[model samples]
Target: MDVDTAPKPAGPLLALRGISKRFTGVRALDRVDLDVHAGELHVLFGENGAGKSTLINVVSGTFPPDEGTFQFGGEDISHLTPQRARAIGISPVFQEFSLVPSLTVEENLFLGREITRGGVLHAREMRKRAAALIDELGFDLDPSQRVDDLSRAHQQMAEIAKALLGRVRLLILDEPTASLTERETGRLFELIARLKSQNIGLIYVSHRMREIRALADRVTVLRDGRHIRTLDAATSTDSELVELMTGRKIDLLFPTITHKPDKVMVDVENLTSADGSVRDVNFHARAGEITGIAGLVGCGKSELIRAIYGIEPIASGTVRIDGRPYEFPAPRRSLKRGMAYFPANRIVEGLALSRPIRENASMTALDLPAFAGFGVLRQAAERIAIKGVMEQLQLRPPNIERPAGMLSGGNRQKVMLGRALTRELSVFLFDEPSVGIDVGAKLEVYEFMKRLVGTGAAVIVVSSELPEVLALSNRLYVMHHGRIAAELSGTEKTEQNVLAGFFREHLLAEVA
Candidate 1:
């Protein structure tokens, strides 16, 4: 049979059959099945803890299923190792940053398979290849630049370029545009379209409905470790896709904000950083209101927030809380003043992934009477306190003994929020709190934030997603070149207006 008339085999280019995995009574994948075809974009959609990640992990060789068979290219490869999976043309871009921070772009790109002559590595050839790759993509990044210094979007592009350097037949991208700007996402889509023309298969895993609608050719919905439905992307709406994954109609993804804005809670004047990432920034967060800071990557938003939270040294400026001068030389000092912060990278700065939920949740409130006993951490008391928090947050399994790492992305975020809540904080700072979570989970986090503000705590959210900012914030501030360029509140807080203001200044200058 010819390639076109081969009856389009009933299976898939890759297929999982009767896959099952269990960890301590939790069925991560319960006889689940999925299929992907050549020259098609397959999307996996599910809420957090619905076993989507487990299914991908099993297929990518991160782990093996207890009972199942994996057929790739009509061959049984059930027990292949991760290295073997990659060798056979399977590539995965994980949500976590996998680049070597200390290595240069050229070195990181060709780390495992450096160009060599006579058993010696050829540095010149590696640099030339990296330069060519950067030029081919029309990116202005320097090949010699250290990976650590590159912006998050540039780093992600480098990862994609590295994967393309190999003989990849199947590409699995997990939240590839979670932090990418609109322009960068457009460029990525161009690259993906180019790859699709060559008959390569793509498995795109993302929580953004917009991206799925634009890129996916076929969509698969998974719920609670079971394969729910597979549909043609052209025939499905975002609401329909979401309902399939969540098993319910979601009228509003963002919760209604009910808290009324009152007095100013956080006031900063002429805040400056030594590196010039943040220069003479001034802003105030109002009590019971969500003040969002929107900016492009490397625009110094994080640095400014760090200075406010006392993680970064302030070169010159004053921070005041309720008309009182607040100078915090460390994060502990900031916490002592009734302020809480959820850092951008949850795995690194937010939680002790290997620690149990009880320990991680109680870490921020160890000094409280409920969890402290005679200068010692009261284990029983801590568990009791965490139990209440877990219930309030709607965490699954409800087991305090599970390691934080074992939970899903959404659950881990909840753990971080739980930690912050334990502090009795009057001011809350959330930095990209919904980065890698599912759409349904993102809604839950937004609702939780609304409830937090109902207690009169002022909230500051720094996010790259413009829509999220428009939805959750009562007032929005766009940061450009380390300064607030535009502020929109009330009826003026539309996505178009915010984006127009952002581009009017930056885009005009670029064109001129």
Candidate 2:
């Protein structure tokens, strides 16, 4: 279904004039004007709280703009609802998934838009269409498989497929490849090219510089809830884009910290998860060193750390902390034994979104005397500590009483990190620490890691971003197929060496 021969539209496919949206205490978007042409792949570039998400929500009818006029196909479509937007060929694939875990791939794909004949459900037809669509998209997903059985990468693929199921003239993708593997990301790029050829306008939101260089024809920079500038992707340098998105000149994104390796704080020997996502992995995180674990998506890097922290079931393993064996580890026990884990998805696993910042920050050490006295909560003490931590993290708005859900992605992550400050911990595990935050926020996270290692703590960083890990880690481990493929340090930590470790040859050469 290529629409390469279709006639081009005269004006923009989607146009907004003075778009403004406001929440209880925040103006998410203010007086923003944007033009998205047919067949164009436009990228929304901004730091968190810069209003990129709000603009897309407005376009996709998640909410109406408080003020402004938007036109689609030369007709006014202000105050649009989600149903109307989808009916008129506007689809949005948000970062948060909307699929039911219990449902099959096809079931989740065509949940509300199921086909029927003579009041009978067209189950077979739906399966056929879903299979065809999956094949056409080159996604390695089975229509019969339950979504819960699929990996995060596959779940992301299913989300994208769901958005592309209908008559989509404008497709909105918010951090679509945040969970995708390299191969799957390539397929998505191919799909985007085909969609562009079909004259479907796409609005993409991503913080990854490589993705912007590869896919964005034009990039719209948003800053401080206003439209900053729209520049050609080819002409815009990374430094210029970073400066525009962050509203500040960042001389260095990653802070330099001297890695003075002390005694091994955490020692894992022949570790294997119950489900075998992590298999017989061996590594050590030394005090005063940022130990980095690098691998491809689904390579069990996160699973390894989870296993060490007792978040995942260990079939056979031993984790020795400070030369003492810790058997049958649990979260409470891990926290009690001076270990803190910051999960990859901050919204899902790290923070209670409905709770206030003070509550979330002090949740880690509530049993301690500083937070509670003889089973009674100390609100004053908790507030003072949380205020200090929030200030150190530079949380935007600095409102301790505000809900965690109201803050930006960066601030939410800060809340999770703030938990560590509430307690005295020696081992810190950060999984995809700065995944979806801004460059400015990422710098802060890097500095935070630097400061943690300076205190002689064992800071283990697990990241999919190669440069981030390489820059911060004193000792790095590359995982492949759920095992430690290579251990690299000093001259061995080069990109070529690390990438070689991603495949089987590095391990094979080690054996040879």
Candidate 3:
């Protein structure tokens, strides 16, 4: 086969033909063809297992495709390595951080590509460059700070800053804004615009429709390891893109549930955590109702639930469950009292990723008679119960023995929700319930929340997505600087009202 050696004038900066990758028994990507031009913000739109990650990995040379012909500036470069990929200015910042936790931001940024004078490490020069990059990115972070000490958002900023340190021809950002605040996201968009102006190609992987609309010049939809469609992002409707990604139409993003509010199931008054992350919070979650706590990222919304669930120590507060005073709360005590809390950082706090699906799902309900009896493990009963719940959650593959780490973001989230189903619970506390998952998974989660409330169980959701919190909640509470700023219900739960609650202190100060 003769390959075209001549470069086409102003053609794609990077191109892949028949890119196919196989793992064990699975074909992760099949006969995929993609072209990314100079200065183009080409978005990779897909659901879980839709080949987005695999495609980017191939581009970054993390995974060599079994079958593919790659062209960079019209030259065939089939044999590509990670070093070669980086040498040619291809950089990827994945959802999972690649930074060393113990290392400072400056050290991590200059890790593999260290500056040296006569083979001696140029530490001062590296630090200066890192500081300049961080400042240019508008990141509120110290370059000397250890990666572990930085918050997830700050770590994300560090990742971006590192990527910008090199002569980047193509920058790949995988769910970059998943952990960022609105202001931070804006800063990132500005940086992206600057990159585009400099004629650097970018591949952005995101499930956010708003981001796709804002940054994407073109979007390529992938599904089940195959190329589905490549459409102009500016002209394509979200419905069209979603259908291509999922192979289905969604009638509603937020499913409606009948609210029949009863007595308060979980009540908190003047709650304050020992770490002072949450301060003087008050709220009530009634049975058969979805109480939403919404705010900007880093607001006390998540901390509020953490304090209530006994994950964080309560410095001062009162919690009443089912009209009974709950004191000295702990994990075991909270579980025994019929409360289930699904944390926002699912991988870290919720699911044990290395464990089997059955184990993770049954972890919360092991004390139940159906799972254990008289200190003896009932393996048969536990397996049956877990499988039943997995089926109800519509878990793909539905294999109880499969490692939780192997599942997609949506399925992994289902594993967490499955814990609540194995036992009877009066209250469900979900923190950032649907952050990284796709639309289809989000709907499934919403349905699960509805079913929980239908059974007269109270559901309290803490989320940064205003639309999700406002639409799902029967009553919405907005947090500002670790306190409840406003509570809206019925007609009062408009976006404007909720947004006002986000900056309540600033607004009040301006008015005064």
Candidate 4:
């Protein structure tokens, strides 16, 4: 699976000239030329469907380019086979990992190509080699530890180690730090620097400017399957990159909210998750207000909201809807108290991807008498209702019959939000609603949230992006270690305090 090839000179390690790829009637990539030198980090920037994935796939030998000249160390590698690409020292680590979770770190490192003697299994030899590689990469990982037990950061590192199992000269990382927390991203960046020191050429594909600014040496912009321009990382600005990718200047990413909050709609006291992930937390959300929850990953912000929505079992908690005590896991009991939750992942937790847009948007109304007559859905009524919501959200080519999965990132989110707004709900829970959506769509969503709160409905939003939360929310609750660490309102709400709240328990522990 791997070849021990000598390292070439520190010149143009990989060159792609006039690369073009097509899928059906769409041109995914068009005559894009990229040159990556040894010990350099080349970043690919684009919008969600901007051909970055296609280019990376071609380079990794998922398929050969239709028209292009690809050179590796000055040697022609055009139309290279996948196995040949790997053997010749090109390894790709995609956003979705290829590691088997049940296997150990060392076992996954040399998964397909194992160390064996006389056709017998050699665990010791494989473990030793894996440990050596882990040490060389300066990673703190036990080779024998199962990948299921590893954190997301460690799992990512394991995938990288697997890519470097052979003579790895060129490393391609596709959104390597997308799922990582702030600290995990920092660790991954440090590892990338170490690889750079070893003269490995890295091609990074990401839409996030923070990652690009931190890692990119030179950035190549792609728009509508065409190479716009390649700019020096040091000279490029976020606005410039946005302008190039979208062909428009977005002066504001988040819209300002002037609406005021009214009466308390949701009130919780001593809430705890059944799994003990979320500790005792007292929270409140008033009608006509957007209350934002801020925390790092695994800080129990999501669990707290889930418990409130009856999606998670509450161990010990008292929740009140309109000041009336509501029991956990409602609807089984005769309580009409409920909340609409928009999960972070629209495809997985939010939308039924294969279902029609009308059905997905009108799913909540299945029990309502307006759309559901005698439990059978009235197709005409559902279509008419959702089409109106789609127009309000400004969904492109608004056709309710289309599948939810076929839409772009922004449109898909709009479809999901439409489902929530179509129903009658007292509180709305949005977890990272603006993630992976375009600037125009993000603003549209924000405006919709303002209008929703304007209708006397309480909105509670959970987001990792601090600026959006600060800009849109009427109040901020920062969670730390399964509990509410700080409640910030008015001038007390700052990014520093909200982010610092993530480390509040750790800081307390350190001082003690």
Global lDDT scores for all candidate models: 0.83, 0.91, 0.88, 0.81
Q: Which stretches of candidate 1 lie over 4 Å from their true place?
A: 1-11, 138-140, 507-512
Put down candidate 2 lDDT per residue, 196-293, tens digits, no spaces. 98899999999999999999999999998999999999999999999998878888888889999999999999999999999888889999999999
User: How well is each residue in 1-512 modelled by candidate 4, as lDDT tens digits?
Assistant: 13334574756999899999986556778999988988899998776557777888888998789998999878888667767888788999976578899999988888778878999989888888888888877666788999999876688788888898888888999877655677767777897897787788899987677778888999998887789999999999999988898888889877767757899988999998988878889999999889999888778888888888777889998988888888755432322355778877676577888988888888766777878787688888878898999988877657778887766677888888887767667788888887766555677789889888888888999987788888888899998778898899998889887767667766985787
Candidate 1: C-alpha lDDT: 0.83
- Cα deviation at 351, candidate 1, in Å, is 1.4
Report the Cα lDDT for residue 410, model 2. 84
Tell me which residue pairs clash in candidate 4: none
TM-score of 3: 0.95
Clashes of each: 0, 0, 0, 0
Number of the top TM-score candidate: 2
Worst ten in a row by lDDT for model 2: 1-10
Whole-structure CA lDDT of model 4: 0.81
Judging by TM-score, tell me the better candidate of 1 and 4.
Answer: 1
The local lDDT score (0 to 100) that residue 5 gets in candidate 2 is 45
After TM-score superposition, the amount by which residue 492's alpha carbon in candidate 2 deviates from its true location, in angstroms, is 1.6
Tell me each candidate's RMSD, in Å, in order.
3.2, 1.8, 3.6, 3.5
**Best model number under lDDT:** 2
Residues 162-240, model 1: lDDT tens digits: 7666677778888888667777888889878876766677898888878888899999888998888889999999899
